[model samples]
Target: MDSLIKDAVKSGTPIDGADGLLNQLTKAVLERALDSELTHHLGYEAGDPAGRGSGNSRNGTTPKTVTTVNGPVRIDVPRDRNGSFEPAIVPKKTRRLNNINSVVLSLYSRGMTTRDIEAHLGEVYGAAVSRELISNITEVVVDEIKAWQSR
Candidate 1:
């Protein structure tokens, strides 16, 4: 166990909030999962020494914001040089998950402005959604609505 978590547990601190031990644990888990998922996608684990001559090796990571049911978090998402890997846990370009998107759209549909949605999401769900992100998500919604209307 991490010392912080251990101490928290020993001290009887609650671990249920966005800034609690559980949140930190979730971040670590997501990061490690992304790293390993990249490793699997590349057909070699990181630092294996065998990937030195491979065509596609570890190309470093990009900072990505992911919103889970627990809260909003920033995670380092690993990538490859080939640019073919599409993360299943959180796909490329789409910041929020379906559940989060539903919540965002629901609030937005209820006359909440983009800034209001951003601030409310950050405060309530720990998601630091950027204005650009909100626009992107809404664009997807717009496209879907267009298609639906046409149908």
Candidate 2:
């Protein structure tokens, strides 16, 4: 990990951005986590002889784009032939990850408008989030608060 950080710095890779070292690292980590999930589901490591007679094997991975606190990361999610591998880290059919909704809510609580939050995401995290999406995230929190108050 130290070597990778040194190499990235030597190459002048930006610390944070859409195409920066952090984004690349996040992608690598998420893909690795997904692969680990698949291995746990299948009960064998990739290319292990123990999986020879296994009824279910690893299928090719499917590419998925998910939003994270770092930015929008494109990761190849591993799949299983049995079609039962549900990743706990990223999950299936879910795009946003890494508590990004929490970030939006925190900003909203600090009196940042949806438009301001949208721009902040784009500028800081390289995420091109729309105002509507930010508003929707905040609205969910507002509704939850309202429900809690009524109780």
Candidate 3:
């Protein structure tokens, strides 16, 4: 993939426009971030001697597709035997990327109900974010909204 990027760069391929190289780049970066998060949560990197025969280890990965502005990106989410690790970059059972939180806020600010937003995401982004998930995501922005309003 590195070589492919290098070739594209050398060939003067434009980096941006729509459904271009940036989407793939975003996917790669997100996957790497998830892997790093897992490594940190485990307290031992994969293949480390300490993790060998330990009570828990990397079990495998589950394919998860996140909806991005670029489009849908499929990523292999790393898993552990204990299943205790919850990814901060993209939480479990949440299909949309964290980047879409702003869009969620914007829609909610426009007086869109949770159900409305949920259906919109399902139709547009192909994400099945639940009402509870929308509430949790919007709850974070509630504080931000208060702070901004006060200012």
Sort order, lDDT high to low? 2, 3, 1
After TM-score superposition, the amount by which residue 7's alpha carbon in candidate 3 deviates from its true location, in angstroms, is 5.9
C-alpha displacement of 82 in model 2, angstroms? 1.0
lDDT of 2: 0.73
Q: For model 1, what is the alpha-carbon lDDT of residue 49?
A: 87
- lDDT winner between 1 and 3, please give it: 3
Superposed Cα deviation of residue 3, candidate 3 (Å): 14
User: Cα deviation of 70 in candidate 2 (Å)?
Assistant: 1.6
| Sliding window of 10 residues with minimal summed lDDT for model 1 | 142-151
Ordered by TM-score, highest first, the candidates read: 2, 3, 1
Clashes of each: 0, 0, 0
Candidate 2, residue 79: Cα displacement in angstroms equals 0.1
Candidates 2 and 3, the one with greater TM-score = 2
Q: Write the per-residue lDDT of candidate 2 for residues 1-151, one digit (tens) a residue.
A: 4665666677788868899977776676566556765776788889999999889999999999998877898989999998988775576889989554556767989999988988887787676666754664555456544443343
All candidates: TM-score: 0.54, 0.61, 0.56
